[model samples]
Target: MAKTLEFAYETPQEVKVGDDETTFTLVCKNEGLPVDLTTAKLITVKIGSRDGYLREQPISIDSLSKLPTGQFKFNFDKDTLDNFPTGSYFLEVWVADDQGTSIYPSGNPLNFIVTANIENSSGATITTIAYDDFVKELNKAASTIVKGDKGDKGDKGDKGDKGDKGDTGATGIQGPKGDKGDKGDTGTTGPQGPQGATGPTGPKADKGDKGDTGTVDNAGLISAPAFHSLQTQVNNSAVGTNLITNSNFSSGLDHWKVNPGANSDCKAVVTTDSDGDTCIHITGTGDACGLYFGPVSFNQNQVTTASVLAKGIGTIWWIGLQSRPFSNFGTISTESYSKIGSIMQADSSSDTFCVYFNPVNNVVDIYIKFAKLELGSHATDWCPNSAEILTQSDYAKIKAAIVALGGSLS
Candidate 1:
């Protein structure tokens, strides 16, 4: 089996979902004559579920070029890699160098899996698998059940007879009787004992002597701190409290800008809501279009909750943080007034913590409002901005207020 065309994945035995690209390095192993460029026909790399490998040769690659060091590189697109589902996959490399093309092994097919990135949760939902994946799994499992040699027949054993009943044992003293059972349910009163002759009227008893007034003395005691029970006030102001600038779109599209790839047709404008609210409306015709607000101060490695309210036409739009699309919460379908959100690990690859949107298509207008990006793994209520909430003066004011009120908060 000259199936010995050696190749190795850059990250052996594992591939992540969101990786921009993955590569397989092919080391020339064909010892055939005329090893130079002219005789080197092509080296193909084909992948299939481990099950599919049992039935076919590798798919043909259009061509393979050699590096100065005689190593050929195979690059796989991760964006579209999701076309294959989660599970093991078999990667086969066959060379048609001057020697000859590789042939199948008589016993087992050569294969391995490009496993789902179980540890990298950022790309949790990308999916693809063979049409008969379940069936293949079942067959693969069944074929692994090799039977062991049979055990020697066991020796027969003898039986024993039953014993006779034993004599009764002597009685022990009885326990004290249990408390008498509750009085039996009362019997109905007998018909007013046949009206006995009326008894003479008894004289009314004299009023009892007045009872003495009772008195008790109270003593000192420790008491728990009294809770004021003041209700937490709601901050209904949507002017400027949010960490995101122009998040409410009240400043129109001031803080928002087009990402690098936007064309002139892909532009944003402030539009009035059908219910009379203001929002940033994006419309255009391009393979991709987007609006982003960011470069805000935030640290990656910490998880955060990001969200936005979107309404308009189209199957879906992206929502989440982005540092050059390095991370996304996935897509949200804008079939209605969708309030989309996700919790993500801040992608530290870039410092930009952006609220981004990319419509599925540009045929219709897309409306977005209240884009919020904040630290923490869970979303809190939409607390709008209030007077430069992050300023030193405001911070001091807030701390002073808390301290003045005798709050224990640090």
Candidate 2:
């Protein structure tokens, strides 16, 4: 396939692992001339190893230089280097504009080398201690010191300044021909007074008649009917209700079946993505092939929905139903994990669900994750089967609750 943009870099150079000062420069070109990057919305470098995409770092638009030539410079900082061991790596520069995203140097990914750091290769042994441990050791050493003589007391602090005096009150209302009396000094507290004699006790009254006894229903225990109802509700909860077994493919291909056409090179396997997330990686060329889910059950006119995160192009289809030949989600192509879904009302025909890729005769490369199938018309987030999520202890507690409520598990 022809790429819209081209990227040329300084002659392939090797950088020592952990070398932060070294920089790598790439010049983006349209046709053979340098492209003006000022108008571009985003420029990013996707770094990866032979395994897959590891990380992406954005290049600031201000950093684009057009002086002698248009280019951007980046370095292998600690964070990016930490994800890489001493080995070969590749990167692709992505340039985006109002048109769309364009990947550069489409021929082959730009390659670079990472060699082992000198310190690592030297095999030097360095001993280190935790700060807390070092502090403890210093305290242990200080314990052997002799006691010092007591110091003399410090001088007392000076007295604080006195507060200002209050203003005199206004003259009292004029009295009617009366002279004012002198104020008397405060009197001393008086002695405690003697206790008074107790009064005579009152006569007791007769007790009232006892009340009637109340009826006890079930002795305050849970009734069998209520317990059964609770048991039914607990069973109906979403816990063990996901219809797609091996939804995440974390269990390899336990519940999945491969349907490869004659002479088809298609196959699916469980693999981890760049972020260490589990997904199904499907790759093949030539004839069409697919990954199928079930001849599982479904009811007439029941709304069933299925969804899966995918990259590349493919279609999810429902077969073995009364709906003509089959029903399928519209064709979808994506460069990243995108959720694709299909909704259908079932007929009594069959319940087989298949995800078709590579169709007829074409190349197929895609990834799938977190597939889900449920009864609602709307697709929901992926969830594992109850056996994968419910722990034995949790189930035990639930069982005990049911038993205590006078219910029995079938």
TM-scores of all candidate predictions against the true structure: 0.34, 0.36
Residues 132-189 of candidate 1 have per-residue lDDT tens digits of 7545544544454445444445444343343444444444455567898665554444
Tell me the TM-score of model 1.
0.34
lDDT of each: 0.48, 0.59
Predicted model with the maximum TM-score: 2
Q: What's the number of clashes in each of the models? A: 11, 0
Best by lDDT: 2
State the lDDT of candidate 2 residue by residue for 1-410, as single tens digits: 23322223222245776678877766555433456777779988888876888889898888765433456777876766755677656778898999998787554565556766756534664334555655555455445444544444444444444444444444445446657676545555445444444444444444444445443334222333334445444443542256767878878887788767434677888899976778887777633455787766634445555667777653333222223221233234565676665544455774666665543224567788887766644445678766578897988999999999999875
List RMSD in Å for every model shown. Answer: 27.8, 25.7
